[model samples]
Target chain A: MYSKELLKGTIEIIILKLLVENGSMYGYEITQQVKNLTKGKIVISEGALYPTLHKLEAIGVLSTEIIHIGRRQRKYYHVSEVGKDISALKMQELSSFLHSLNQILDFKLSS
Target chain B: MYSKELLKGTIEIIILKLLVENGSMYGYEITQQVKNLTKGKIVISEGALYPTLHKLEAIGVLSTEIIHIGRRQRKYYHVSEVGKDISALKMQELSSFLHSLNQILDFKLSS
Candidate 1:
C-alpha cells in the first residue's frame, strides 16, 4: 500500500483519472482498477473509497447509476460533463506544481 | 477559487507542502496560508480543512500540540518524521504523474 499520508490527498485524483480513462465503473470495480493498476501497491479500502465516491457524487462531479446484478445492487460512477473539464484543469494545475517541484529537486541535476 | 474537482485531490498535498515549507502552523494559519498562496483562489473551508487535519493526525502522519493563545485553545499541526519522508515520496510520485500527463497533452502541441 502507498503511504497513507500521501495517498489521502490524491485518492480523488486517482478516482477521477480512472473514470476518465475507463468511462464508467462500479465501486468495487474502481477499487479493483486502482489495485490492479498499482499492482497492489495502493489499495483503496472500502471504508475510504465509499465515502469518497459519495462525496464526489454529492458535489455533482460524479453521477451514479444503480444496477441490480443478481442479489447485489451495484452503484456505478462516471464523470459528469463538468467533472471532465475540471479534470483537465486539475491535470494542468498538478502539472504546474510538479514542474516547480522538479525544479527544486533537479536543480543540481541540470548543473 | 480552484476547481473543486481538481482541488479535492491535491488539498492534502497543499497542506503537507505548506507544513514542510513553514515548519509548523495552526489550523487557521494553514487555511490562511493556502488562501494567500492561491491569491484567495483556493479556500479550504473549516468544514473540510478540520477533518483532513484530524484524519492526518489520527493516522500518525501528523502530530498536534494544543496551545492556549488568549481566549482559545488552538491545535497546531506539524509533519511527523514519517510524514516528512512520505511527503518526499508523494512529491516524487505526483511529479511522475505530471510528467506522464504532460507527455500526453504536449504530444499534440509538439506536433
Candidate 2:
C-alpha cells in the first residue's frame, strides 16, 4: 500500500481514466479492479475511494446510477459527457507528466 | 506546465530524489535542473516548491546551509541522514505507485 499523501493527487485521475475505459463501476468494484489490475500493488481504501467518487459526482464529472444488485441497491458511477472531456484532457496531462517524471528519474539514476 | 493539482502529490518525491542524486542544490538551481533534466516538460514553481522545501526542513528530513557567493547568500538544501532514509522509503513507495499507475493506464489504453 502506498502512503495516502502519495496517493492523494493521482486518485481522481485514476478514477477518471478507469471510468472512461470500463464504463460504469461501483465503489467496491473500482477498488477490486485496481487491486486485481495492479496485482495487489495498489489498494484503494473505502475512506479515500468514496469521497473521491462523491466529489467527482458533485463536480459534474460523474453521474450515478442506483441499480438493484440481489439484496440491495448499489450506486454505479459513469463518466458524464463533461467527465469524458475531462478524462481525455486529464489523461493527456497525466501522460506528459509521467513521461517527464520518468525522464527525470532515469537521468538521476543513470548519472 | 501541468496543473498544480497534478503536481501536488509528487513534488516532494521529485525533490527528495533529486537531492539524493545531486547532493546539495539551491532553489533556483533545483528549478533549473528539473527543467533541464525534463527538457522543459516539468517546471517547479516557486510558490509550490518553497513551501514543500520548508515543510520537509521543518519535519527534519532536510537541512539547509547558507553559503555566501558573490556577496549574496544562498540557502542550499541537502538531505540529512534522516532525510536520506526518508528519501529511500519515499522512492520505493513512489516507484511502486508509478508502476501500478502505468499498469492501470496501459491496460486502459490497450483495451
Candidate 3:
C-alpha cells in the first residue's frame, strides 16, 4: 500500500484521467476499476475518494448524474466539457512532472 | 510551468533525492541544482522551499551545517541516516506511484 502522503497530490489527476477514459463512473465503480486496472497495486479509500469527487464537481470540472438501480440511487460522475480540457491539461502536467521526477530519481529511461 | 497543486506533493521527495545524490546543498544551491537538473522545466520557489526544509529538519530527516562564505552565512542541508533511509523509501514509493499514474493516464509505457 502506498503512503497517504505519497498519494495525496496525484489523486485528482488520477480521477480526472479515469473519468476521461471511462466516460463516466460511479464512486464504487471508480474504486473497483482502479483496482482492476492496477491489479490492486493502488486503492482509493472512500474517505479520500468522495471528497475529491465532490471537490471536482464543485470546481465545475465534473458533473454528476443520479442513477436508480433497483431502489438504490447511485451518483455517477462524468467530465464536463470544461472537465475534459482540464483533464488534458492536467495529464500534460502530470507527464512532464513525472519526466522531471524520473530524471531526478535517475531511473533508467526505458527508451 | 506546472500548477502549484501539481508540484505540492512531490517537492519533499525531490528535495530528499537531491540531497541524497549531491551529498549536501544549501537552499540557493539546491534550487539552482533542480533548475540545472531539470533544465528549468521545474523551478523550486523560495516560498515553497524554505518551509519544507525547516519541516524536514523538524521531522529529523535532515540536519544543517552553518558555513560562512566571505561576509555571508549559509546553512547547508544533508540527509541524516534516517533521512537516507527515508529517501530510499520515498524514491521507491515515487517510482510505483508514477507507474500506477501512467497506467491511469494511458501513457504508453516506454518498455
In the order shown, the candidates' DockQ scores are 0.09, 0.42, 0.47
Against the reference, the lDDT scores of all candidates come to: 0.70, 0.83, 0.84
lDDT of 1 by residue, B1-111 (tens): 443544544567677888887788899998886666555666788888899899889998899999998998988889999999987777666545443333333322111
A4-107, model 3: which lDDT tens digit per residue? 66676678888888888889899999999888878888899999899999999999999999999999999999999998998898778877766776667766
Model 2 lDDT tens row, B1-111: 786676667888899889998899999899999999888889999998999999999999999999999999899999999999988888877777777777777622221
Question: How many pairs of residues collide in model 2?
Answer: 0
Runs off by more than 4 Å, candidate 3: A109-111, B109-111
Displacement of residue A111 (Cα, Å) in model 2 is 23
Among these predicted structures, which one has the highest lDDT?
A: 3
- Model 2, A1-111: lDDT tens digits are 777676666778888888988898999999999999889878888998999999999999999999997989899999999889998888888777777887666522221
* Clashes by residue pair, model 3: none
RMSD of each: 7.9, 3.9, 2.4
TM-score of 2: 0.83
Model 3 chain A: weakest 10-residue lDDT segment is A102-111
Better of 1 and 2 by lDDT: 2
Q: Tell me the TM-score of each prediction against the true structure.
A: 0.53, 0.83, 0.87
Superior by DockQ: candidate 1 or candidate 2 = 2
True contacts kept of each: 0.01, 0.50, 0.50
lDDT of 1 by residue, A1-111 (tens): 333544544567778888888899998998887666655667778888889899989989999999998998989899999999987776666545434333333321111
**B1-111 per-residue lDDT for model 3 (tens digits):** 776667766889899988998899999998998888888888999999999999999999999999998999999999999989988988887677667766677664342
